[model samples]
Target: MVQSDSKLHEVALQKLNDRGVELKEIAELVYDLQSPYLAELTMQPCLESVKAVIRKREVQNAILTGIELDVLTEEGKLSSPLQEIIEEDESLYGIDEILALSIVNVYGSIGFTNYGFLDKTKPKLIKRLDDHTHSNKTHTFLDDIVGAIAAAAASRLAHDNPGISKIMK
Candidate 1:
């Protein structure tokens, strides 16, 4: 592989691994989703599509959105009624998921489906990393925020690399 491709792969693997998603599991999921006939439809050549969405600027936006609410909680900035609801990660506060979906939407519907699956599955590593974030007494919102990014990255990989699915089988 070209050096840049290798680097991108490494960065992607590290991000997912750190967030608690196993490479093998991700590969298996990709394998399960693959169809030989659909190979031609892959977004592989656009490998950077997902990464572009998860770029630092985009992630920063998510962080700011989440942390702003968190800060409001800390400073008693929000009114009691609003505070209670915001603190609960309410259904209406689905901006996070929406932002996350933006990253996966690049590759098409398949990417969206993969992201949903991974997010719901909450595989062991993801849970552990999230727990660690909460216990660290730091920016707790980043736990889900980062997990979403990692999951999106994994989905990007699955969508871009047909080779990954072949390896899984």
Candidate 2:
């Protein structure tokens, strides 16, 4: 069954992959964040939840826009001052988090809390994406975008599965 929108999301996910972000990695991260709470958690369910979250057009759009900005920064294509800000990933520049909030808003409150944690902790690939000093490639917005995806996926899993609710009891 081929839905018209499926292609759009596939394209978006491909763009993320092209930029070195893997859905499986985000899925695993989601699994890690959520599994401790949802005792019955497994990779397959986590992957499904992650895919479901990505299926949203809004999520797809955010992913594409953020990754595109990162790529442009990497290529040094953006105009002077903007390029410098993006490359440096200045503290005052928060549009990255704002764009990412679009993804977080989809899954409700859990998304916000999870995003906050992941954004602060910068776990694994998230850390790698934010480390711009050593690598020529700049992540700037990519780190927040990646954290948003993982947070949303975790939120989705927590929402869709009743097991998590039970565990909360």
Candidate 3:
């Protein structure tokens, strides 16, 4: 990665941290998605996949944009119904999911299905991020970003290790 890319990566990571997201949380989601498919798996590769996904410029932009919007909403800086829509995470407010798909689209078609599953299940960390009742924080975008990262990482992991599928065939 170039210096500018490195800077973007660093800032994206920082934004995730600022939003209370840990890499382990994302990695755990990857494990949950891939472990059932892999005969034997470890968190190390899952973590590596997440790091790889985060390094992508596309993902960095999504992270920055989504988190900025969520922060703006939380601070009540966004305007009118737009703010209310994002804050409430209204079912019709599919923009968040649309932005998240940009991150998942990087990997492959598998990511689409993985993202759907994670989004529907709302696994532990995602569940926490999605909780609007406990605090004034807004994760309307962060939660989807987190799920997208995991879905992308899981897709990468599946692509990297195809031994199981090869054996099955």
- Which candidate achieves the best lDDT against the true structure? 3
By lDDT, is 1 or 3 better? Answer: 3
Name the better of 2 and 3 by lDDT.
3
Model 2 clash tally? 0
Candidate 2 stretches greater than 4 Å from native? 1-4, 163-169
lDDT of 2: 0.85
The global C-alpha lDDT for each of the candidates, from Candidate 1 onward, is 0.50, 0.85, 0.94
- What does candidate 1 score in Cα RMSD to the true structure? 8.6
Candidates' TM-scores? Answer: 0.51, 0.90, 0.95
- Against the true structure, candidate 3 reaches a TM-score of 0.95
CA displacement after TM-score superposition, residue 106 of candidate 3 (Å): 0.6
Q: Tell me the lDDT of model 1 at 36.
A: 42
Where in model 3 is the C-alpha error above 4 Å? Answer: 1-3, 165-169
- The sequence of per-residue lDDT tens digits that candidate 2 reaches over residues 118-137 is 98888988988888777887
Inter-residue clash pairs, candidate 1? 20-125
TM-score for candidate 2: 0.90
